[model samples]
Target chain A: MNLIPVKTRILQKNENLFLFFIEYAEKNINRVIQENSVLVISSKIVAVSQNRIMNILDIENKESVELFRKAVIDEADEILVDKNKFFLTVKNGVVIANAGIDKSNSKTGEIILWPENIQEFADIFSEKIKKKYALKNFGVVISDSRVTMRRRGTVGVALNWSGFWGVKDERGTKDLFGRKLEVSTVNIADNLVSAAEILMGQAAECIPFVIIQNLDSGLFTNIQQTHKSAEISQEEDLFQISSN
Target chain B: MNLIPVKTRILQKNENLFLFFIEYAEKNINRVIQENSVLVISSKIVAVSQNRIMNILDIENKESVELFRKAVIDEADEILVDKNKFFLTVKNGVVIANAGIDKSNSKTGEIILWPENIQEFADIFSEKIKKKYALKNFGVVISDSRVTMRRRGTVGVALNWSGFWGVKDERGTKDLFGRKLEVSTVNIADNLVSAAEILMGQAAECIPFVIIQNLDSGLFTNIQQTHKSAEISQEEDLFQISSN
Candidate 1:
């Protein structure tokens, strides 16, 4: 597997996503984008491109800090923790601090909300990428990082994906000894995102895109993708706390 | 980043981890070992090498079902959930189902315990690999995969690491707009492991090792590595559920 980070100048708000991609490919990765490659994109850039951004001072009747606080509450599906300095909220069926509203690396006094309808964005983006490159087997993943339970630093998570199966179902698969494996479905999208996140530094590095190559063509398909296969309902979650 | 999976025949119990590595390097990766590379290893192989195997029927006066149940309880620091088919336990300060005890991919009737003192093993393995290859800097990560909350498929986790700082701290770093980034530490070890996990396939794939090249040398350090550097105490944990 080859992971290549695409560095860019600071992305401007409402910039064209596909155009920026083309500019980068033409400038840096000319002729390198190939079939069976996966593109891992930072969701912040997509959100900015969608104009999913907020300015603290623009809201009425609240201080700057309170404005940020209100945004978290407004966007959160559920607020799990309300710490003095941090908010852990469930957004789009996943627990993300502040509903994945990124404040850093943006224009001062502005925050980028998690991109809306990310699945649609990824689906559209994949079409544009594949059409421009004339590639049949390609994948696109919109990604972000979150702190998992009982862990210190953040781990990558796929917000949405297209052009391939995000999770590889390994049910009924045999192990080395021909015995059925247990709970072995692999989350390929999150894995790819996490790999790309290392090169996409969280602070100050302007790399918002990553190109991954050397994938098994089996991972790609024209089948439409959905999150249902990768989601375990709250009632069925194995690690759910009853009170939650 | 270049990730090269080293496929091997099914590893045997009590095999020397370092010797097996030497054999693979001589046969396949004769001269590709270099400084600033990370070797992501599946913890199961390390546990097997350590002879951390147990037979379910060996315990006296207990049914096989009861013996497996007892093992889960004995190994867990705290068993958070006890279900008919699954056990969610906190082992070594992290939430892992069944205390990271793996049953699949093993000889029938045997289970592999999560290797004891993994940091020590990683440290020793790093030393042997570095000396053998005469590399100035290298890293070793003991890895596993787990299903995160609300997610269906498993994502990779680093149980322990050696020869580098696992978390790259960006505590006081400025963002693109010169604003201090928030909660911006990068978990490099987990990221690398997660990347390798995609190629390391959870079932039937005989690839137990992944060599990662093309890392920034600044990530390596002579400072001693410790879990404490990456751990957040229960008191300091932001995602804490007070009732627990």
Candidate 2:
């Protein structure tokens, strides 16, 4: 599969990402995304667009700030605390530090968290793009950078998705030798999002979005779109270990 | 990205996998891959083929067997000690088990360990296949099913590989916005082998091999084939916790 990284302007806090895409599309800025291509946006941008910002300073006490810092550390994997008050995870995974908190592109001193309603945001964005372009089979994936335990660095993971098949195949398909397979379906959307994240760097370039095309359309029939709560279980979650 | 499971007739003790492949590839095989293709073979077949068999009954005392068993457990993530004699661990990143033993595929009452010189075997098999098929860029990977510390079931991992690029791209290229990528290059051969292993299931079918093609060819230009010694470091290896 060919990976193309889209170059877009830095997203300002409180700015609607969908509106930004609509504006770009109207200006003929991103024509590479054809009628039925998929657009993958970072969850940070989605969260910013949805105004999901929480500031540690606004929290009443030092105890709460400390607890939140520990939670962010545990859930995010890698982190950097800046200026004694701002905690950022850098590419380490926690997008809370100054790296994640924005003042230049955001309201003053207001730390922006991820979008509140990511699934709804993805659905609305996908619907708007489809309606405006008259395109069928278009998709939108709200992604976030995450690090797996024992592995270093981060890879983009899908937080919410719409207009695409979330999973492909099912267990019990016959192998080439005719033996039935069990428990072998793949998470196609997650894999595609991971592939797309190769182009969305964490720092510097600020290309927080990507438009993917020429994907195998046959893999887009059984889409499973859900909110973050549905995808993350409190128990059996590795990220929750340090948080608690 | 389509996966096809391979099946082989049940192998007897002292069965040579290289010879087996030579005979198997001769019939029904359409093409012996020339470039950007990999062959996945079971490490058990390699050990049995190379005549690396042992017997626990031959040991003088229970203490010796117990010590060996403990070492196996310590080194491996999961331990399956059947009948208190035979041992197995599905896929846990490392390739050794029973401390790498075999009895079902070996002579009665005898257990086989992994091959002594797997890279040598791979080199020879690679040469033979190339000469026979008049091909240029194929690879042979001896794999074993292993289980991890916290994970369940068996996953295939490459024990040894030859005639193929071992690790693909190191992250040095800039993203579209000119941000330098760090630590992003992946072990492409290992991931591809793992992908193939999901299809090459154990039990019943006895599918010991698979052929993978259509991988990106750019990966081969800077091939980085590694040996077992390179995989382990005496200084930092935690599994060397106990002295044998």
Whose DockQ is greatest here? Answer: 1
- What's the alpha carbon RMSD for model 2? 9.5
Best by lDDT: 1
Please provide TM-scores, in order, for all candidate models, with all chains considered together.
0.95, 0.52
DockQ of candidate model 1: 0.72
Weakest lDDT window of 10 consecutive positions for candidate 2 chain A: A235-244
Chain A only: list TM-scores of all candidates.
0.93, 0.71
Model 2: per-residue Cα lDDT over B1-244, one tens digit each = 2233456776666676667776665563655455666677777667666666566552336865675565456445544333354444422334334555433344333545666677777777776776777767777777754432212233344666777655444456654335344334344444445545444544343667777665455544324365432243433222221222
> What local lDDT does model 1 show for residue B98?
81
Q: Supply DockQ values for each candidate.
A: 0.72, 0.08
TM-score for the first chain in candidate 1 comes to 0.93
Residue B233 CA error for candidate 2 (Å)? 7.0
Per-residue CA lDDT of model 1 for A32-60, tens digit only, reads 68999999999999998888989885332
